[model samples]
Target: MAARPGYRVAVPRTQPEQQAPPVQRLRVRYAKRGRLRFTSHRDFSRAFERAIFRARLPMAYSSGFNPHPRISYAGAAPTGSASEAEYLEIGLAQVLDPAEVHRMLDESLPDGLDVLEVVESPGGSLADLLQASRWRITLPGAGDLNGLVEAFLAAETVTVERMTKKGLREFDARAAVLSLEAQTSGDVTVLDVVIEHVVPAVRPDDVLTALASVGEFPTGIVPLLTRVAQGPLERATGTVRDPLTPAS
Candidate 1:
């Protein structure tokens, strides 16, 4: 009898079983900052695929005509902003020594990108493991951020009108902001904002709205906004660095 479509005939076992155990999976954390941070998430994914090929890492691909390599990113950074800490995960075809894979990937990444660390991911996948992210936004000229930050903190609720695919939606920006702190860097003022993404997603737009409530936004494009770090800020023992630091 002929086999059904999309079905394969089972063959009798002829080979001996392997004596050794299979290799373990590895999860790597990579940081993309500076000019590279401005690249869109889709574009960055393509860039990393090419970089993986160049690095000769054993990346696994999906089983399809136009197969895509299995990879996952923790969160997306806004375009035009710099970031110190970003994350992505690449699953290997076979289990590899974490250190070796980390070394290979670091060498393959372009400037402004770095392999921060590599280890066995806590969960089955990176997406399952990620919980939250942290961001440090800098506004130009220290333009009355003191009043804005104070007002924002003192408010019971701050509502902002945001555009959604379903038209427009208004949300309490304060609810989205898990934490916020104010500081100054020479002339510019910085707001270290951390939002919980384990549930709802937060973006620079939310911050823009909150800032606008208490201060004036630049007439044109605003000053630099950079993502400082990502992932469970309190967890994960890895080498951490401030994104604003100059490349050594």
Candidate 2:
């Protein structure tokens, strides 16, 4: 059937991206130090993406038209809180030495966002291992922390309200608290506390609010909070075991 004098057909020229599943997954432990503690999660994400480019690591990308890096972050500390332990995982197209990646990433990022360690993931989810956190809260001019802590522990349920993403809500502050200890020096007091990660996420401020309700805690006292560690809760030792460890 050769009936047309002149006819042409347009054919699209496009192919699917050949992004592969990650061959190697590496978990990284980093620290948010100095003024960089105030960087929001979004800001840190952008900075980390830039660092990946600067380091020139071969990152694995997801399949599709708009491919993106295969990176995931777990249990980021709240904004404005300094942290010694933070965890993230990245998939790589080519296998690389974890130590070298750590060194390169540390060099690429700014001073404050320090790469503490990087290790090959044995198996399982990093987020699942993050069951608890240890924090040191320094309160200035807060009277008699020992008394306040004692009172807080004595309560069976200390209900407090906090403004969350879904508006105002109330939860039991005592439920999330695994342990609390206080040390006083001159006019300052430091609280060493272990908190279990729970729904609604009990924060240090919420604990203080619970204390105020339970005891005659002095007002107008400002506190500096820092997350020391976060990992699986070791029941026997009452400590957070390193999540990067294979056993955890």
Candidate 3:
């Protein structure tokens, strides 16, 4: 072969690097009902992962060969009870409209799971800002709910002895209780309470301990417990999807 004359290869110009879209973190509020209520925290997390897979949610993953989805749960309610307020934060691969995400999640969920709200979670994780939670509990009987609240309030310190995994522990029920009030409509009496879910966390059994101290909770029947809201951070603190309203 004839030797070709040496020629310099043309250098290609580098185009400006494109930036990836910003990842979005969102808070999703969902409900647990029916047989699903009995699911433990781990079970719920697993279920959510499967449902997300089924829903084909645009979940963002950590950078690794075996990447995990970026999801964080606020906390879990006790097993075998229904909850109206439960929340989790998930990072999305792409920023989608909150309304659209909400609708999609609702459709993707199995029976007894309801998507209540989807909003932008800014600045803090649910674990950080969740100082307290509100619950409305209804005992089995029409028995004196008002008296129970009054008794619960009058006590200087209500103590509940619980057996944790570590050992027997005593918690001040009064300290956990922020507000306790009673309301009656038709046949049932409702005990609406806002309690401090302190660091170690208070269980529904702890509340029952307080109630049982005042008076017996309707035996054999689990009380109806519904979590209404959670946060130390207010609507003013972050970018909430809805219009701000004064905390009640």
Candidate 4:
């Protein structure tokens, strides 16, 4: 091989690869409630890494010039919405009690973002185990939405459009909805829905769009959506089981 005149070849640098697996791994379920629900995913991730450091956790890091802690997150609820079953997994360089980890991290994180449960991973991927999500959406002053929900469910397919980073796209929102029901929570009317995991994930807002298309949804009304649970779906019951709970 010969070098071209006035041209220099650049060799790509390779960083050392991580050699050992973490001594301990833990899966955690947490909640984003109240004002903290407005926190974006990036903001939460940065805060979490800081919490790990502040808690003096022996977190496992990747091997490189810029090593990042080995923390894996499952599908996160959209911003501006609360969640009770957000999930993440962390790798640790040392073994520790799962309960103790939960207690310490819960104390370290800011209020409104609480750690609900922690379990030692039994050697499996958390992402693969999660199959669906259940949500509760409250619409204040919107009146009864039972007719709209019934119409949306009766249809074979209810398409909705939303502006995404890749431009406006259309998808069938009805297909992902496993169950939809209207219930009263004190003074507010709530829509309890269970949605199966699918590509281009359907959000609570998309479901609302479908409802608006089918029936009357009062204008000037804002919806409060909260992800109630996310984990393995029970097809018979159309509900998601807690990942932290052992299968019966």
Candidate 5:
């Protein structure tokens, strides 16, 4: 092939990639509720990365052939359950006000999945700050399970089997539970529980299994579970503190 007379062939040019250093790490408290709660952790991560890019935030990325956004997530709530408290930290190339970042990201994300709070990390890891979690389970059309709960709590160890990637394993669900109480409202019975963050991470279903192991749990009743809080446990109060809140 030959170039036409009085014409020049154009060559393609590649743009240089520029890397920026992270100036700030923002700790964020978010929520997974409603239909969005069904979103898997991997799905949420991908959506968040897309949101960060759509919002045009100067996010920091790791160094590698396949660099990923510098985002670190604390223990995430299980899928198919709603959560009021969830935590993650993101590194940014430019320093920005936490409140502004919160508002921008909140608007950028979809409904249901919300950014509740954002704070400037005071030089600590988010994973280490989480010690316990508060959960609420609502069983509709189910009668009170007070006696069943009492029996389960009285037992020294309530073992339950769960299928993990490794294989089926049994663990003591009683030791991880800090407190458990049943409350009734109309036709729905709600169970409020505070569980310590431990190995295997006993979920609400595990507690239900323990309850069933002792006594009869109403069959065909699917309960609604929600994680109300997650953070450092206050031994005196037997409750978790907000990670974003500074100690008094």
Candidate 6:
């Protein structure tokens, strides 16, 4: 566009954006607690980018017109669900001490979105290591939750329908469930669940729907679902180990 006689003409860039490739990758373990649990993954991404800026991190950026920080998120918990274990990886232009980065980022991010741990990634896939999750669901004023669990497990296939971007589809929620048990503490019924990561990842709501169909599920009462841990499942004892730890 031409400028007027007195107006200054804006100069267009002739060169592509230059950005450095990542020299190091750091894996982060964080928690979503309190009201921040309602923050969606997209929301957290934006918050994290801002935190990176505020913390002045030496983040590696992609090359081209729209260069962005090299950050990858794996196994995000569902929105409106509290989580003790969430994971992400960030590529850096310069290598930094994980502890230092952790402190910087923790201070930068908002309260309730806590950075629990940061470690230099060993050579392996973090996604591959996150094979399963241990989840806790609290049902208030619940009765006979143990019976419902037994009924759910006894079934060969417990199918539930969930509406996806593709539309509503039937899913076998029982298949991914490695273990499901309930323990009552006074008036509250607590559910301990270990579910394997599978295609068409099952959410806690799916399990609840399956339970509703298989047994008596308390209506008009919301369940408190929280992901306690995420990592590879130990087959022998049926536990989820920390994903960041390298195998011996």
lDDT of 3 by residue, 2-59 (tens): 5558966667876544433339988888889888888888888887888788778788
Q: What C-alpha lDDT values do all the predictions have?
A: 0.66, 0.91, 0.73, 0.90, 0.91, 0.92
The TM-scores, one per candidate, come to: 0.75, 0.91, 0.78, 0.92, 0.91, 0.92
Candidate 2 residue lDDT tens string, 1-248 = 55466775656969877887999999999999889999999999999999999999999998888898998999999998889989999999999999999999999999999999999988788899999999999899875678888988988999999998899999999999999999889988899999999998999878889988987887788778889999999878889988987672
The list of candidate 1 runs beyond 4 A from truth reads 1-23, 64-66, 164-167, 198-200, 215-221, 233-248
Model 1 scores a C-alpha lDDT of: 0.66
Global local distance difference test of model 4: 0.90
Judged by TM-score relative to the true structure, which candidate is superior, 2 or 3? 2
Model 3 backbone overlap count: 0
Residues 1-248, candidate 5: write the lDDT tens digits.
Answer: 79999999997765446557678999999999899999999999998988898888989988755677899998899898899999999999889989999999999999999999999988778899899999999999879899998998899999999998889999999999989999888999999999999998898889999999999999999888899999999989899898889888
Off by over 4 Å in 6: 1-18
Candidate 4 structure quality by residue, lDDT tens digits, 1-248: 67899988887988677645689999989999999999999999988988898899999887767778899999888999999999999999999999999999999999988999999998787997789999999888777778888899999999999999999999999999999999766668889999899988899999999999998788987899999989998998887998777789
Clashes per model (N, Cα, C within 3 A): 0, 0, 0, 0, 0, 0
Q: Residue by residue across 91-206, what tens digits does model 1's lDDT show?
A: 67787788888888888878777777777654454553344556677776755466777778778877777776677777777765666787877867778777656333557568
Model 6 scores what on Cα lDDT? Answer: 0.92
For candidate 6, lDDT tens digit of each residue in 1-248? Answer: 77889999788878886787789999999999999999999999999999999999999998888888999899999999999999999999999999999999999999999999999988577888899999999989887687889999999999999999899989899999999999998888989999989989888889999999997788877899999999988999888999988766
| TM-score-superior candidate, 1 or 5 | 5
| Residue runs of model 5 more than 4 Å from their true location after superposition | 1-20
Give the root-mean-square deviation of each candidate in angstroms.
7.1, 3.7, 9.3, 2.8, 6.1, 3.9
**RMSD in Å for model 2:** 3.7
Poorest lDDT segment (10 consecutive residues) of candidate 1: 238-247
